[model samples]
Target: MTDLQIRATAAPAAPGTTARPGLLLLLVLTGQFMALLDVSIVNVAVPTIRTDLHASGAALQLVIAGYTIAYAVLLISGARLGARFGYSRLFQYGLVGFTAASLACGLAPNTGSLIGFRLLQGVGAALMVPQVMSLIQRTYTGAARARALGLYSAVIAGGMAIGQVLGGLLVSADLFGAGWRPVFLVNVPIGLALLAFSRRLLPVLPGDSSRRFDLVGLVVLAVALGLLVVPLVLGHELGWPVWAWVALAGSAAMFGLFGVVERRIAARGGQPLIPGRVLRAPGLVPAAGAIFLIMAGFAGFMFAFALHQQAGLGHSALRAGLLSGPVAVGFGLSSLHWQRLPQRLHLPLPMLALAVVAPAYLVFGVILRGGAEIGFGAEAVLTTAGLAAGCAYSPLFARALSRVDPADAADGSGVVVTVIQVGQVVGVALLGTVFLGEVSFPAPARTSGHALLVTSAAIALAFAAAAAFALRTRRAAG
Candidate 1:
């Protein structure tokens, strides 16, 4: 190991370190909570942003897609960068960047500027998020690690719920007459507070001084994803021009080139951006497929539901946020039981849960069609969907990483996260477009809600097919 690696690996804990781990975990979790919360918190604010910026529907889509694309593309590079420059240093820098970017986003006077700022904010988030898992792995061991993972998982689920609630409150509060700007600005105080705490709380991890930056791999991957995703997101809105198809075709060729380059790098004894062996793992294919399908369904539902509740139901942002709470609660409740289910069941619990979740969405579709008023009944169905999603997600992730070597953990995580992010883009593009097209012919007031319901049903059917395939593959392998 190089001197930096030695320093990173051999960094000493503070004297009598009992309280420090707990304190560090808390600080880390706080930052992570903010990062995860921002993902969905903005959903409820989409309409507000649209109106405020005088944005087209396509512009609004770019606001969300821009962040996710940047986030996904940067994740692997961020991990490698942290390993070279030091995790603590990168994390602190990321925190500052994220806070600054949030401010920029809040203060952006136009749609274009807002989208640019959001992309920058995503880069900061990508830098910070990978460190959370890496730090956990490095800091905690054995039962402590397990407990930390459990806590981390719980916090993640809780944060998703809190985002909606907080988004609602912030948008409705219109603090300082900033309107939706407060939603972005809210991160500043929390981020600054975390920065203060991190100085004392985070243990310095050693860096690999000899680690060479994979500039070629990074450029190739970024270009490939950008070519692929940017077009998908923009193409539908632009009426699918021939250039979109050309871009899509170019993306496939870029991906192929990326693979070949990575292989060459690995053969030459360098660390490639992504290790091909990890991707070739036996169970990874199905796991990835399942992840893609599940996230596609989930993202599409959220996008459509946000529009339905606000535009269709004539509800305020706060009411839309409140209506979404049951989904969060359901996810939390189901997640708590994840560890216990596999112990009692002979089958892969994730596959089983996914199987159940498809039906839950179908039932939700029925509920929507039945015209149940938005009260307890709507809440119950949403909660049920959340529970089913929670149960399905935890196990799917566990299965994906079950056989991965520790050395490749970060890479594996990055790959899965990137795939999910891409899935989200596709989901919004395809499902959202379908819904929009369907509703175009309908009367103004009645269209959005009905379109949303149909989109939900479509997603449910896709999830069912995916779940069935996963279960069958597992059985065949056995």
Candidate 2:
């Protein structure tokens, strides 16, 4: 065995350690929940923040998109950092940074300060979020790992759901007459509590110190991702300017350059940000494609649906949030219980779940096209989509990493996490643009209906494409 492997084997829980596995799981998952909650929590507060700060439209967009942009760009590097330092150590550092940044965001005096603090928040999230998956991969085994992943999936869905609900609630309540500040400030107490418990509960797993940080690869990949994601995030809001199109074109070239650099690094017998061996793992590609598709479809649906209700139909933020509860309920239910299905059906289940998702979206599109109100049929369709999404999310995640060696866990985690963030950006940018373009500010109910119909069709197409990837994943697994 290599010297690094020797140290890794010795780095797990010491013989006399008292950390309970269950508490440790809770500790790490809570950290994940906090990271994800921040992403969506700010959405409902954007209007409030703009009004309170007298911010410009561009600044408001930055406040909304800055966190995501930084998080997407830095995630892989953060994963590599975990592999260089210890996972537990990096998680702690990230948590401290994230908590502090959240406080700064809540207390910002103006839009510029808030934007800077939001980017810092993303930096902390990039450092912290990737480690959640790496820790789960390294610490758990077999069925326990599967269950942990199930809970992780649930937290993901739950975080998105709760962020909307809680943000609306906090803003509406205006507690202490604080309109939008509580949304960011809420994390402070939760983060502080998690910090106090993390060091004691998390296992001290050592990373491979021999693997050098690939500085050149990091720079190339960061630029590539920045070019790709920033435009996708801000393009629609900025009315698809020439700079956005140019950035999109530039991203493709940068990605090509990044691939060349990774190959050269491998040729020289040095570590790349993502190892070539990990990229070649069976099932990883198809699983990743499916994951991208699933998230894209779901995120687009969520984005367009929110606008359809609030901007198009003149619904209140709180009511819109409540209306979307069925999706979260369905997702949380299926994600936690998918394991109980017959063992013989396991391999084909993700594809079947995705099959269900495609039709549900198609039906939803039809309903929206018909100018259907937010009634029983519409809610049912949303729930069905959520259930199928929940089913596909966990299994595809497992399939993607199942063949990855423990030594490559951080690399694998980084890739998956980055794909998710990118997928959400693409979904919102593409479908959101379509929706927004079809309607005007103060859009009539009829105009909103047409816009939603078009967005739903696009989202349905995305799900259909995802189902195809899921099929390929099934074949890959077989």
Q: Which candidate is the best by TM-score?
A: 2
lDDT of 1 by residue, 1-478 (tens): 2111222233333222334888888887888788767767787888889788888878888887788788889888888887788777888988998899999988999999999998999899889877776777678765566666666656655565667778888898889889899888989998999998888878778677887778899999999988988777777678899999999999999999999999999999998998888887556667768878877787777777777777766678898888877887777676655665544452465667677777777676666653344767667777877887777665555555545556666677677666666777778767777677666522354566567668877888878866865674353223
Candidate 2 Cα outliers beyond 4 Å, as residue runs = 1-18, 54-61, 237-239, 369-372
**On residues 83-193, what C-alpha lDDT tens digit does candidate 2 reach at each position?**
788888889989999999999999999999999999999899899988887787677654555566678767865676566667777777788998899999998999999
Q: RMSD for each model, in Å, please?
A: 4.9, 4.2
> Given candidate 1, what's the lDDT at residue 447?
61
As a whole number from 0 to 100, the lDDT of residue 52 in candidate 2 is 94
The segments of candidate 1 whose C-alpha lies over 4 angstroms from its true place after superposition are 1-19, 156-161, 370-372, 440-445, 472-478
For model 2, state the Cα shift of residue 286 in Å. Answer: 1.2
Report the Cα lDDT for candidate 1. 0.74
TM accuracy, model 1? 0.91
Angstrom error at residue 78, model 1: 0.8
